[model samples]
Target: MDLHPGEQILFAGRPSWRSILGFYVLGFLGAIVVGAIVKAVDKTGSGVLAFLVIFALVLLVGFLKRIGTTYTITSERLHIRRGLLSRSVQQTKLERVQNVNTDQSLLERILQIGTVDFDTAGTDDSDFTFSGVANPDEVVAAVDRAQRLDPPAAS
Candidate 1:
């Protein structure tokens, strides 16, 4: 659907299975560390196994939560909705956008997914990123169009 005059979608994406697998691998490593610590303290294999299983479950839940979040861009503002338990909604007005950056890592390039980073004029850091977007170029074009259509107010 076309964005409304005052509405923009910052990002719409489905996290690749590859990305989810990567998280799982990281979780495995974390599980190993926890297992080692538990084994050192208790000298029991059950503790290690239990910790590993719990770690895997936690990572799976986290991956699911990440998949649920939506980051959007509207004509007037940027919006981020994240988390299942304690949801977070952060909005940044279009007028505050100072810079836009696009980046693709090796895996992202291979998978044709890129991230768009937005730098707000008064923010401490550029933490707003549109992750795993399929067509970053199109998004950039849209952002440019929005900026042109809505010029910032004079200081």
Candidate 2:
């Protein structure tokens, strides 16, 4: 199913707030760990503060990048567009898809969201992953439907 020339959109649903929250929580934990390590080694309050500032900056950039990123399932293929400075666009045809996997962490389960990983035939470490997707079951169903409608040809 080929998407029309200019018909791309985000995933079927919006990103889960729970996903965003989890990202922030992880960022906070990372900041703490980095700060602690710096403090233990350097024994300087300024080093910890510097680590905290740097961690916060990295997290902020990641948050903005996540917000800017989008996943599009077109009639023909799945499209992922992301990044600011070094933008990347990946498109995988439905017929080329070999497998699909949905994963949910304990936190994702509580939040009712997960990530969908796409495995395309003949690809080398180039699987497409849709992160922070809401209602992963629905996304999986959609992917299955797409795959069933257009299975890959035998090699």
Candidate 3:
């Protein structure tokens, strides 16, 4: 990530590994089932190869999705960058932040992962969020500190 002159990064991270545990688990189970069916039908050792390939593809997809997205909080703004080849960036100044919210599902709570949402003023993009982040409270604190360190300019 390139920072502007004098821009100080407060928090920067990608989705936690634990956040994608469900994907891994599901893929593993599915691979096992498929492998068993193939082995039963073919009576050959190729089932093992099929299982490995399926599991590997799942892992690769999950890894790419997780690493392709990034959340960044700087003294001046909050930014989210997504996609690898075709990049999309969303950012808003600290002064424009209208609300900060944390959302967690039951599974996410168990895994200790959550999404930190930022509602910014005067923007069409209302879905800005740090999804699947670990330790959401820390992210919130970082945002608070950034805002405090560089308070909104006086009118």
lDDT of 3 at 94: 83
Q: Which lDDT values do the candidates have, in the order given?
A: 0.70, 0.73, 0.90
Q: Give one digit per residue, the lDDT tens place, for model 2 in 1-155.
A: 24565444324544555678856777778888888878888875966796679778867866776666777775458877777678887877777777889999887898888989989987885658888888888877777666555433445
Give the winner by lDDT: 2 or 3.
3
Residue 51, model 3: Cα distance from true site in angstroms: 0.8
Which is the better candidate, 2 or 3, if ranked by TM-score?
Answer: 3
Q: State in Å the error of residue 128, model 1.
A: 2.0
**For residues 35-111, what per-residue lDDT tens digits would candidate 1 score against the true structure?**
88778888757666867686879687767766777766656677767777788766787789888888988887787
State the weakest 10-residue window (summed lDDT) of model 1.
10-19
Per candidate, the number of residue pairs that clash is 5, 4, 0
Per-residue lDDT over 36-137 for candidate 3, one digit per residue giving the tens place of the 0 to 100 score = 888888887978988999999999999998999999999888889999988999888888998899999998988889999998888988798999999999
- Model 2 whole-model lDDT (C-alpha atoms): 0.73
How well does candidate 2 score on lDDT at residue 7?
42
Compared with the true structure, the alpha-carbon lDDT of candidate 1 equals 0.70
Which order, best to worst by TM-score? 3, 2, 1
